[model samples]
Target: MRILHTADWHIGRRLHGFDLTKEQNHAFEQIEQIALDEHVDGIIMAGDLYDRSMPSEAAVAQLNQMLQQLNLVDKVPLYAISGNHDSAIRLSTGTPWFKSTQFYMYTRLEQAFKPVELPDTQLFLLPYFEPFAAQQYFNDDSLQHLEQAIVPIVAKMKTLFDPNKKHLLVAHFFVAGSATTDSETQLKVGGLAAVPAGLLKDFDYVALGHLHGKNALHAKNARYSGSPLKFSLSETKQEKGVFIVDTEPFKITFKPLTPLKNVQQLTEYFETLEDKDFYKDLQLDNYFGITLKDRKPIPNVMARLREIYPNIIALNRADGYETNVEGSGESGKQIRQKDPIELLSDFYKQVAKDDLSPQQIKWAQEALKIAAKRESK
Candidate 1:
């Protein structure tokens, strides 16, 4: 059976507070197009179908629309599991109905492990689970580690799994070989946090998720399809794609997907406002995170950049001597002559939003004063 392996859709996810619904929709369209073009028998989404456990109504609508399009327009079966970001119950709401449509979703560990038999292969779906959840599923208090908890589950699954047939396993977990970035949230860590790759050796091919970077993990028969979009500036250089797995002979190929908006980080040193062309050189069509090195504070720098690059997401000024102070042997330290509390109040006034509550402002002021005193010592 030919299958497309993709994961970490993160539908309804926002980047730098900017909504990514449009980008997500565009991506799903590409996925459907790929399915049609490839004539794949099935599409397997490893996990993280939504950005949050309690997804927004708009998120739900978008996901439903995409699922319907994939099923109705493409006429392909989609097997999916809930990741750490999803609420198991929410994703599994229409399990019975979805199964009829050949769009299977597994949310709970108890509901997982059972092989969903297709015409060409038997797929073992393992949804995202915490240690506590695994413990509850097995009804065993002795299950202390995630590896240990999964051992019994896999052992039980192996009995049901027909070794004679082509078997595929879908899972969402943090394996050792995968890479992680600041943008991706880490799973809960405890004694029951990890499940080793060795446990899945019985399966023909294992499609994994949880890490965002493509080619982050290495296994002879296992791989991560990676996220469809770049989630962070650190991932700007990554080639985002999905994996195409052929189960009959057991071969895997990567199919690249286009990203709606590229993310780029730029650093520049500025001595005067005339360095405007430096900002213009960057691709404004993509989101830009910029760091400016200036000897002194430039008035309305962000406003000026906004004129050329409207999609600038973040800005930081390097505080080194060259940027903040020119030709000064001693580090320029502006002495605060005002009362500590008043100085803190002014600092809060500069950074706090207009909608900040009075209590919040008061607390911030006090916290800043305490912090400053600690630093002085």
Candidate 2:
């Protein structure tokens, strides 16, 4: 049986304050088309259906439309589980009717025990769970960490595995030795935790989530299908796609997807960036993190660059030039040349390491004016 493996849709995700709804919708279209074209038997969504636990109304609508088209209309069985980013309670609300539509969604750990048995494969879909949940479920207080909690669970799953059919484990936890990017929220951020890859040798294939790159893990049975779109500038080089796994023939195929607007990084000087020839072949709509090699600061640099590259996410200096700020960057003489608001803005940027919002600047201006009036009195 051939099935499509995918994870980390992050439907409501944004990049540097920009809404990604359009790009996400475009990705959903491609995924739907791919599923129909491949004529796969099943679609495996490991975890992270949305970017946040409380997704927007629009996000909900967007996901519902795509899911209806695939699961209800197309008649492909969808096996999914909730990740760290999803609200399991919300997802499980109307799940009673899901089975009729061939939608098997595993939100709680209790649902994971019963494997979704296909003709040629048995899928064990496990959602993201805390150590405390496992601790209580098994009545084992010794389950302190993620790995410690999962080992016993997997042992129980091994007992339920069918002898005739191939086994596939779908999960959303950090595995040991898996390479991670900034886009993924590290499951082990608290401490030494990741489930050891060697512990999962029983499965024919391990469809993973949480990591946005397909090449994150190096285990023989495991693979991260990765995010459908580039969520971070760090993921510029990552080939975003879905993985197709065949049970009988025992094959894995990666089919790439083209993002509507991809994340990218570029480094160039002031004059080079402005040249039309330099950017002629480049995708202007792609999100960019740029570094300028100019030694001296250019006036209204971001404004000038934005006219050509509309989606520049970040701008930095190659030499780490810190101008219009206090102490290290600018002399007191240069600081004195600036207006009160300019000085306050620069000082705020230096101290806070962020730009002053317009509302904040307005409040500061009023405070400065009040100070001036008091001085006159």
Show where candidate 1 strays beyond 4 Å.
184-192, 271-282, 318-377
Q: Write the per-residue lDDT of candidate 2 for residues 2-104, one digit (tens) a residue.
A: 8899999987888999999899888888888888898998899989999889999999999888888899888989999999889999888678789888899
Estimated TM-score per prediction? Answer: 0.82, 0.87
Write down the TM-score for model 1: 0.82
Residue pairs that clash (backbone atoms under 3 angstroms), model 2: none
Superposed by TM-score, candidate 1 places the C-alpha of residue 361 at a distance from the truth, in angstroms, of 23
For model 2, give the 10-residue run with minimal summed lDDT: 183-192
Error of 2 at 299 (Å): 1.2
Clashes per model (N, Cα, C within 3 A): 4, 0
Candidate lDDT values, in order: 0.78, 0.87
